[model samples]
Target: MNKMAKILLVALLAVVVASCGGRKKLQENPGVSAEIGDTTSGIDPEIQAYMDANGIVDSGRYNLSDPLSNKTIYFEYDSSALDPESDMIVQFHAQHLASTGGSVVLEGHADERGTREYNLALGERRGQTVQAVMSALGASNSDVVSYGEEKPVSAELWQNRRVELLY
Candidate 1:
């Protein structure tokens, strides 16, 4: 009946109500259990299969060749702005590097549309952007390298303009 006792009683009632609300929701939606649903369930079926076959779960460590992994961060024509998906990938790898204490090489490449020197500078800039993200996420043991127009993952111009992380 005292102020302190009343406050404690109200707090206990609030906790009980909150706990009961969750229990009722769980009972109503028993099929949506977190243990039953996987994080990779929303990904591409092919990518999911590949991850399963390779024993790679949704642990944030990327499998480069997997389409869902977003390993290679592509740049728009001459822009180095990181895409949301690629930014997530960089953050994931940055966390991995921070925990593992291993060195990573950020290899930057550009399409053959520009002059060799210009492409080299562009590639360097892209690599530096990725390095900056990594540094922000506590990755210090990283190296940036520019392939410029010398290296192209494929004949496609879009594919060429990318920064790949080598761990």
Candidate 2:
């Protein structure tokens, strides 16, 4: 074979080998499943204690119509404080988490009216505030994330300022 042709063949072989190795790695680590079990049979003792303390009844299965299904809570302009309605929403989620021992991600967001850095800090503060309330209500596992003004749900500024709970 010509030298140039041999070099091209070798390069193609290397590319194929690298791609196959990546496929092998993906097959080896298939990642965790997203499916949740239907029954709450083997809950941790501490979680059970928390459920009892919070007066949460385990109905064996999660209720699709539960208040925790309401994932988003709005905030006033430049404020991280929870109003009465938001407080009630957070409380409901906290009770669900305590009962199910499930983790939650509090994603904080802000409108595009402020500096990016300031908005990011405000978003973080909002998420942390929700996390604090959840923890105080016996829900332990939570993460606070700030999206700032990067993700907007609506053109209206009031609608854009919000925190979303992700399970």
Candidate 3:
């Protein structure tokens, strides 16, 4: 290879190597940060009631509020429409913003009672419902997102049904 090309290749390699080693030339990346609290240990009271009504326990639940789950807001049956209840849920999240500087993800979920794609759409709507509330409450829209997953509504996986507020 020519001298100029060789030098450029070396520079590229060095940049890659530096990035692998955590070099800060390109801004060492800003600060950083799940689904639910550890249900295997126990569950929060409100979450427990949510689980009980749905015939699931928080134990071993993925998205259920176990200890430190970001929190979630569930929509009415087959509906993504927001309500007064969702308002209170977003308020707590607003407080969370004051303590931590981080982006948030909203996961939308639906009970496995419909087609996978349809359920997924319903789930996304569920997440969007909450995301709207958060954005309305002053949270940045760019930092929030939701995925529609056909998660069961048992305390076991019900945690997955509600919008997952992740950081």
Largest lDDT belongs to which candidate? Answer: 2
The residue-by-residue lDDT of candidate 3 on 1-167, one tens digit each, is: 35674355335433333332321211123232121222244444544543344355333323333222335666555677754334334534543442243457777776655567887788777766666655644555424344555445465444446776765
lDDT of 3 at 124: 76
- As for TM-score, the candidate ahead, 1 or 3, is 1
**Which ranges of candidate 2 are over 4 A from the true structure?**
1-66
Q: What TM-score quantifies how close candidate 2 is to the native fold?
A: 0.61
Name the regions of candidate 1 deviating beyond 4 angstroms. 1-41, 44-70
Model 3 residue runs over 4 Å out of place are: 1-70, 98-101, 141-149, 153-160
Q: What C-alpha lDDT values do all the predictions have?
A: 0.65, 0.67, 0.49
lDDT of 1 by residue, 1-167 (tens): 35674345334433432443443343335376552223334554543443454355664433433222344777879877776445545755665566557688999989999799999999989999899978865788999999898988798888899998876
- If the candidates were sorted by their lDDT against the true structure, best first, what order would they fall in? 2, 1, 3
In model 1, residue pairs whose N, Cα or C atoms come closer than 3 Å (at least 3 residues apart or on different chains), thus clashing, are none
Candidates in order, TM-scores: namely: 0.60, 0.61, 0.49
Task: List, residue by residue over 96-152, the lDDT tens digit for candidate 2.
Answer: 566568898999999999899999999999999899888976788999999999999
- Residue 100 displacement in candidate 2 (angstroms): 0.4
